[model samples]
Target chain A: MAVAADGRAAVAQTAVAAESRAVSSNEIIAEFVDVHRHYKMGDNVVRALNGVSMKVSKGDYLTIMGRSGSGKSTMLNLLGCLDRPTRGEYRVGGRDVSKLDDDALSNVRGHEIGFIFQSFNLIPQLTVLENLEVPLFYQGRVGAESREKAEYLADRVGLGQRLAHKPLELSGGQQQRVAIARALMNDPLFLLADEATGNLDSNTEAEILDLFDDLRPDGVTIVMVTHNPTVAQRADRTLWLKDGEVEKLVTNADRADAAPTEESL
Target chain B: MIRDTWRIVRLGLKSLMLHKLRSALTTAGILFGVASVIAMLAVGEGAKQDALERFQDMGVTNLIARSKKPAETATSNSQSLWSALSYGLLYAEADLIQASLPTSVVARVREAKRPMIRGEHFHTSIIVGTEPSFLELTNMQVREGRWLGDIDDRRLANVCVLGATLTRLLFPLENPMDQTVLIGDDDRYRVVGVLSEQGRTAGAGSTPYDECMFIPLHTHQRRFGDVNTTRSGGSFSRERVELAEVKVKMPSSEDVAAGAQVIRDLLAQRIEETGDVLVTVPLELLKQEEESKRMFNIVLAVIASISLLVGGIGIMNVMLATVTERTREIGIRRALGAKKKHVVQQFLVEAGVLSALGGVVGVTLGVGLPFLITTWFAQKTIILPQHVMLAFSISAAVGVVFGLYPAWRAANMDPVEALRHE
Candidate 1:
């Protein structure tokens, strides 16, 4: 039964890829063209990423999956604008971010991409409300509008009453929720989450995944990097990386078929 | 930008609040530094003002030619007792000084120590023989009756002006004016005037003017003669001195140095046997004192700066530890879109606020310490507003200077590496 569902998901993924190619360039939120990332360790040049090309459209929920040395970390760093590709073009919101300087890259990171860590990296010193205002504070837009937006995002994440509480005072799942609210505070082009649910228990993981699922249809783009197949199965599409190369592109149908019990839950 | 700065500063303050004891200890370094700076400056200022007052009391434009007993030479030992060693300012020298410095006002003074008697009330005090111009030159005022005029001096009238202290001792209840006071055993003088009360610090010479009695020069010359004798340890010493002091007031301060030089040259030629004349220019002493005071103030400032240096080192030490402890927090802020400059600004603001708080407390303590010193220890101290501002500014500057290294280290961290740190 799983094999039959996998065959259906393969056919659905080919169709979705064709449909994405038919969409206009303006609809693409981020695009990586023939990107390469190399690091020098002592005397050896380690090729982290080589000539990989992909596109993410607006409102797309995509996931990148790989093992330890497969360069998924490099992909997340590049996508979040925290780093630049060595010799390729990385465009976010129609601007080439790969050629930008540190300050400009910081600007893109502040206004365009929101990040969530596996540890739920909320500033321990700040309250949940202050954590949500971090990105807007960097953009020098911290005023009534930012406060109102932070309040609305807090309510949306079901943490409205806990706005004044610190991150250390909250549970792991609750901290992750606050991180999610902080990621959406700037209304960025996409949310880049690295191992978003790796630290949570089974039940809390399901809840966070359900929250991601609820946000997907609302036209909020999310790009997540993780090693767990179960977590990757929730996204609209999955990109599998192996030895600095794209191994496979899995679609929603394939993920749903591979884990029917989880999909049903 | 201002609102953003306020947010960052508030964030810095919040982070500093995490380690309350550490923060307070670090603040204490700056506190003592600022307080010491202010206190030292106040002491230096007080000393300078005291010196200025003493110099002003001596008449800044006046040159004094005083008589001094020459050291006994081998030939002076051959002189017999009662012959009286005549080594001092003479009436002839005074006339020559008046002739040489025509643009100056010269006042001659003959002083003697004698026991004054009013009935049975006897008090030993200085008796000063001076002309009428002496009152105007010394800036003295008469409280009752009238001062001696030229007619009283020419007629050789036996009238005297009693000092404030002497009047109280002699008259007690009745007015001292028109009273008779006996000098030595037989000489009697009528009191024509009483001097007003001058404060303790008003008299800068050997004898306070408030405790002396003034008599006309002719009357003193006729009654007491030009010789004074004293017996000590079974040995009799006598001095034939005509004038004890000659005070010359120059027309302008610019002429004082030249006039003093001219008087010294004139005395050097006349008194060939020994250097019996002592010439002192108050204006020169005032200049030398002012120069030394400036040096003293500079030394005090240097010492104060060293304390600030030590305080800055303390701040640096605390900030370095904070940076090490908050490596992960810096990584989080960097990930949340804080630039390197933003990280630097946040840490610098934290340091600045810590030192500024210390400076405020230190200024309060610094200003209060002088009052305590003045009240309890009887030491004069003056706290100028500029001194407080200077000390506070230096402390804040020390914070920034010392905080630079740690802030730079924080801003230069690799975000991935920092986040990975435990």
Candidate 2:
């Protein structure tokens, strides 16, 4: 928390440190161009995010890693459409969203971005299937068709038999699976996970990551924010943030065909 | 839209069901409020109905003038003791009143207390002297035999009609028809008719002819005379009263007021002198009763509304607490794409469902409470449809109205802060 307060002056120098390094022809689904988010805390202005740029493309898996003061949470909030950048621009599906009003931003969140939280934030009052229906419900798409879709997603997460169970009744891993199924309800452009395995045991975290891996062939895009290096290394590429700015971008060396260029395909 | 509302309402119900005891206690507040409202109004309506029945029994178009023995008559005539003080409605006044209301029926009545005896059955009661028109004016019908006719009055025959209750008191077992009752000393009047039972409550001036004996007007005048002598514990008194009461029946209900005014004007001079003749107009009393009833209903509504307001406040209190407790849930919903209005609607619908449930049960209890009152308390109760509707709608509106502040607070909470709420 104190690092975040002291990092305000370092934002300017680190802002120019990193940029997208993927040499692929995949279509861009979402992009952030030099985004800055500033808040005036009493007498001090806290620069949470300063001049950071990144891109998420179709069929790609990327992770954002930073210390507590490195704007990891802010990046998650921005990616989820829960907060807008104070300067620069955020685009989803090639349209600028930072200037949209609350309702319109909420519409973008419902239709484009899917979020998975560290706490597996499924509404406890709702059953697994009902939790899966939340995203579509906001779009007024609840009916037999949505219910069928929910059943299909629940089965995909291996929770078909637990559709009627409340989130509180499920284990941390099972609850996170429900959250994942819920995210897929809208067929979002990409999944934005904020420390998705922060509350899980090692065994469950590996299982959930494998579930993410299984969706890769289906052209599912993902953007994750985590502070754990082991979790970050599982992604195709890792973007590091320091002092509210991207510090470096590293492509995992062990992953074969790390960049799926058109020529390689 | 209706389907959407119904869906929201169903969801609200499920959420409320999670805290069953809390919801039930909140509902009790409204239940009792609605119950008391219906019950109180019912009691008021019942009292009004009772009064209405009394006035209706007295006959709306009829004006009664009863003879009262003036206090002055007692003071002045005490010197003589036996001079037979003359007071009350004079036979002359009856004639004048008959002439003025030419289209009306005037039944003049005279009362003579006498000991009448039949086969081993003897009692002392008032023997009423009246014409044939008395039956029609009093709304009394003959159950058996025949009522006295004009010929019986002209001949001064000793024929009488026994009141339904008096027949039981005097005759007991034997049929009163063709029987004879001996009045005073050697004055025998045959019972020629029996009146149907009149379930009227006797009012002031000793009315309700059910306990009286009806005889020919001339027979009473010829045999008993105008003077009534009484000797109580060696104290002697004699009073002369030509008529006991005069009932004037108007052509219709609308004519009662004008007819009463004409009669009042005619007797104005005599009333000032003796103050013994009191005229009773029932129509004016009925109108006054109507006005007072409206005031009573208004009072009842105000009282009922206050109770419902208290109930509404109870709902508001519960909803505010529920919103505070569900802050994290609101944040989760907002993160999952729920808008501010959605959060507000969710809580508002929950409150509405709570109160509407109370209304349903409240109506059931309110409707049944009157029957219990009639059975256990023996109090008359009338349940009005509009009252039920008013109470139910008000209860529902109370939920929505009281829920506004809490729902707005929930909707306006900062999502970022709420998400971090433990």
The candidate scoring highest on DockQ is: 1
What is the clash count for each candidate, in the order shown? 0, 0
lDDT of 2 by residue, B207-281 (tens): 457778889888888898998888999887788899988889998999998998998899886577778888888
Leading candidate by lDDT: 1
Q: How does model 1 fare in lDDT?
A: 0.84
lDDT of 1 by residue, B1-422 (tens): 88888887899789889998998988988999899899988988888888787767667778888888888887778889768888788898899989999988888888888899998788988888888878766777899998877787898988999889888888888877788999877788999999998754544247788888988888878878888889999998888989888888888899988998898789875455577878888889888998998999999899988988988999999999999999988887887788889889988999988888789888988898888888887768889999999999999999888999999999998877777778
Give DockQ for candidates 1 onward, in order: 0.48, 0.42
Model 2: docking quality category: acceptable
Q: Which residue runs of candidate 1 sit more than 4 Å off their true CA positions?
A: A1-26, A254-265, B200-205, B269-273
What TM-score is obtained by chain A of candidate 1? Answer: 0.86
The global C-alpha lDDT for each of the candidates, from Candidate 1 onward, is 0.84, 0.83
Candidate 2 DockQ vs. native: 0.42
Deviation from native of the Cα of residue B1 in model 2, angstroms: 5.4
Model 2, A1-265: lDDT tens digits are 3332332223222222211322344768789999999988999989999999988887789999988999988888888888889998998877899899878877888887788889988887888888888887778878766777777677778887898999999999999999998887777778999899999999999999999999777567889999888888789888888999988878775554556221110
Question: Each prediction's Cα RMSD?
Answer: 7.2, 8.6
- Shift of residue A263 alpha carbon in model 1, Å: 22
